[model samples]
Target: MAAIDVVVPNYNYGKYLRTCVESVLNQADVAIRVLIIDNASTDDSRDIAHSLAQDERVELILRESNAGTHASFNEGIDWAQNDYFLLLFSDDFLVPGALKRATDIMEQNSAIAFCYGRDVAVHGDDPVPIMPGRTSPVAFRLHKSRAFIESFCRRAVFQIPGSSVVVRTEVQKRAGHYRTTLPHSDDYEIWLRLAMLGPVAELDAVQVGLRTHDSNRSREFAARQLEHILHTAAAAESFFNHEGGSLEDCGALRRLARQGVVGRAYWSGIAHLLRGDMEAMRLLGFAIRSSPVSAVVPPVSYLMSRPDLAGRISSFFANSARSRHIVF
Candidate 1:
């Protein structure tokens, strides 16, 4: 059996540390090791990590300072001596059969870059359930190398759950480690890079428990939506540059990417408007720049709703849209 190293990067998640570590420890019939990298957590995480390290299967890396999750991932990757790697957050846990299922697929087909599965999102303090379904309904579904990448370009959202993914260590190193610069979109960018290199495998059922809490990056992204929009657009641009094509194809692909960005901004702007957030105007401005004709209608309708601000409408539109046209 190929060794599977599961790195649990934790920061102030001491309460849930045991549940997360035990889940990895309990994964059946695989040569698995758990690395608990506590990022100078102020809570009881260090104590819990020390306890977990007593088990021969578990290793601990207690950082002196919180260098952030990306840094933890890089350090963990360097420490991994296994064939496969999983960067599991301390708050999330794996389903019982996840490791065995992922390992079998990777062992059989060496070409697969990574294998990912859907996760059951557990909100707040809910207990992680024993996922009831076929572990391997079919031999894993193989995604064509660039198929997922092109799909992401056309539709600006990453569907894979980060914790549920098992990546080939060699491929992960070759693709490059997570970019510490992109706090919210590092996983999105790395996944794109991996997809570009080789085919990805998709397990049919849920294999991970994704816990949603206030500290989750998704929540943070929602509060500062413009950042999310910009990060996604930057990732798309990177993909477009790296996946070169003929001039016409490149032009067409660029337009499609822009359309995807504009669509996301359009919908997200409407959501902001419904909530009466002033950021709606900024997002709408982004949309308008990307697709001028389509983006103008929503903002115009919004302005019509607020007759008192009629005088400032034109000026607001002019100034907000003045920034270089970023597709959402």
Candidate 2:
């Protein structure tokens, strides 16, 4: 068996599949097996993936119907047999020599459930450094303790990108596979659970090239994604409660949820303001109440009771506001 099992989950990204596969296959100094799980792509992705799987190191699993990204990821994890696993997305590629570095770290630290490195975000051939200062959390960096893992789940800091992380097969198994209910943030949710299990090692090195295109989920549905994240945060809090976990570090989770709701409300308010609707202003006011600073809600609302202020705030966020790039 190979020393590592790599799972590449592909949807309709046929154009980028070959490069992604080649990058993994091209890695030197690491004994790795590659599994491509295609989610019934309407494009030629499956055919290309199957063609590439002819190599002994590569295998292809073609699904009859399109399972969502999370489902495909879980299927790949279930089929993985190596001591460690890496889930590479169809739109991403492993940087040269990244495999050696990631595998070496995992081998050196038995305690590390996973290790992640940095990434270069690409728009076509132009590369942009994302989360430059913050370390990549997606590639499981080091062996984590169970307490730490649980804490991560509670804190909701699993900002690691799925394509950038490498996980120990055992650690993943122990933590349980991805939760199917979380269609969008499955990777984030899983990493939170993993961090709860142990300490995550962070290597400040670039390991993958993540392609950011117009069709990417984050870009396509920013508002919906934010909403889902907020809902997921709430669900995570409930999960911890059922497990008898304490709420000591819950402040961060609450803050994150508040931020999402606030941002959503602010934007939605702007949309309503543009239409000259008073109900939208009222809804936005209610949303502000759900924020961490909700204590000042009545006073603030009183101060900005004018519909014009609501419209200005909405315009400010929609026009000049930047989304937080924090992975979690």
Off by over 4 Å in 2: 125-158, 223-225, 228-235, 238-287, 291-328
Supply candidate 2's per-residue lDDT for 127: 40
lDDT for each residue of candidate 1 in 76-98, tens digit (9 for 90 to 100)? 88887779999998999988888
Best candidate, TM-score: 1
Candidate 1 similarity to native, TM-score: 0.83
- Which residue runs of candidate 1 sit more than 4 Å off their true CA positions? 132-134, 137-139, 239-252, 271-279, 296-328
- How far is 231's C-alpha from truth in model 1 (Å)? 1.4
Q: Please, what are the lDDT tens digits per residue for candidate 2 over residues 71-164?
A: 8777877888788888898888888777677767666667776778777778864543432322222344344455444434333334455687
C-alpha lDDT values of all predictions: 0.77, 0.65
